[model samples]
Target: MADPLDLFLAAPPGLEPWLAEELRELGYAPQTTAGGVTVSGTWSDVWRLNLECRGATRVLARIAEFRAFHLAQLDKRARKVAWGDVLRADRPVKIEATCRKSKIYHAGAASERIARAIQEELGAPVSDDAALTLKVRIDDNNVQVSVDTSGEALYKRGHKEWVGKAPLRETMAALLLRAAGFNGKMPVVDPMCGSGTFVLEAAGMAGGWQPGRDRAFAFEHLANFDAGAVSDLRRLDGGTSLHFRGSDRDAGAIRGATANAERADLTQATQFDMAPVSDFAPPEGPPGLVMCNPPYGARIGNRKPLFALYGALGETLKTRFAGWRVGIVTSDGGLAKATGLSLTESAPIAHGSLRVKLYTAQL
Candidate 1:
């Protein structure tokens, strides 16, 4: 039997612990790191992680690791590694190199050497446009080579094709949902749903659906891919019945969210309506969670109007939704406080160029 491969699940900054917790729930022992979580598994584990993990931006498998002080040694060692076991001679690959505090100070030169080695040894064509990527990092004279098993960012999910301005990524949405203590059992409500990302993700979790089911992965191009095993892994079993709801003031966003729910085959479990936060109300039955990512005003260049919006949202939640939990995502603390809810803030999270946090409360 081949040794287990080292798998790295890339998490957004400040969400490592939540991602690690999610991985542990999936029955894998994960060590949380600054940027992500690391686990030891085989190629089959690689495919499963890419398929099941919702909070990971991507999954990278460490193909080779060694020490090289200079370019000659790097090229020689790169060529000696067996690339044929994972990469195909017919498929093109893209090489991306990062050099940090290493004798190999020039990243472009290192990438060129590795690219040439793959061409000469594996007979594979390298192209910048290729979807399959090999990430080479030289840090403190330690060289690590990894392959991006996820072709597109897992946030794509191939379900919600429409997005509004400065939309929340689906991966981040999943992690935030986990952070909010959602376990696929409670109902979810998003009053300011942009493209219904939170609603759709909640419905998927309740439906026992795989986020990667409707998509393709870069691992399919690798030599170790098993078609039958992947087919078996994609088979889903029982799921609980839950109603996830969302509403938006924008008519276009409502239409798009409904379409996205249809595409995900989750319309029965979700409902997107055209309504503002002032008109928001909890669905019938026991109280669940009210989660939303409202405007932060950084993009709008004004913070005054958002205060009213947040205050109105807080008032609505407090007045109508009794015994429900609340989670609001935003970059501004003052805005989050404007709601007047007793909320606790999460660690600073990297959202594009802005740093945001998830504010939680129970009312």
Candidate 2:
């Protein structure tokens, strides 16, 4: 067994507490810190986090940390750190560097030096297209090198090829679901579900499915990757009896969401329909939660008509979804309030270029 690596799981700003809570539930004692959660674990823990964690944007494993006043010092210190234990000697790798408040402030120079050291010491080919990356950070003359264990971010999930305008990312949806207190025991409905991210994510959790089960990770290319061992971490609990439902006004969105659900193998537990907010009908069972990432007018459309849309959505939820909770994600607070729902506000979070927040209320 290799020594425990310093694993930093990056979550969207304002969501570190929830991510830490999730890690505690997953049996890891994580120290919640600004920007990410820090946990010490081995290669298997890295693999499992990349596989099961739905809220983490990137799972970074710190391989080396040392002080280097200059590039030559940096190169010497970098070469002394163990690389063969975690990285493959024959595999291609990429280097990314960031420098702040350090004597060796040239990020590019630091990356080049480290890359050269890795190639000369470990005989690894470095390239831009490599699946493995060594993230170098220099701050206050202290250098830290970590690897992005999760490639293409955790939200890609490999099943959602089709997307709608201002589509909700899978990671944000999962965090929102967790924020909304969804335990996967009851039903979930999304009236304005773009590509069915919230619905599908909720359904997968309800079914005890691994978020990364169908995806490929950058850690698979590392030297310590154990395919047989990681395979055992997958959830074999089968599907859940609870249902998840999504409705979109656009017919194309409905079709795309259904196909995406099928691709995720979640068709048995989810439903998608081409229906507007006015047509929302609670499922046969008990009321669960109504969550939606509506059109946030950041990249797509105007905000005028969306006021009516929000109002209609609020009216429908208020009249139809009694005893059910509601969650909405949007950048404009005015639009969220336009729904006429008494929602509790969360701190602003970064989504794309716009700042958004999750509004929660009981309907």
- What TM-score, over all chains together, does every model reach? 0.98, 0.97
The whole-model lDDT of each prediction reads 0.91, 0.89
Candidate 2 C-alpha lDDT tens digits along 34-150: 877999898889989998988899899988888999999998888887789889998999999999999998888999999999999999999989988989999999988999999
In model 2, how large is the Cα lDDT of residue 240?
A: 92
The candidate maximizing lDDT is 1
C-alpha root-mean-square deviation, each candidate: 1.2, 1.4
In candidate 2, list every pair of residues with a backbone clash: none
- List residue ranges in candidate 2 displaced over 4 A: none
Model 2 earns a TM-score of 0.97
Model 1 TM-score, all chains together: 0.98
Backbone clash total, candidate 2: 0
The residue-by-residue lDDT of candidate 1 on 1-363, one tens digit each, is 155988899988999999999899899999999889999998888889888898999999999999999999999999889999999999999999999999999999999999999999999999999989999989999999999999899998988888887788989999999898788889999999989999988888777888888899999999888999998888444355789999999999999899998888888899999998999999998888899999988766888989999999999999999899999999999999999999999999998888899999999
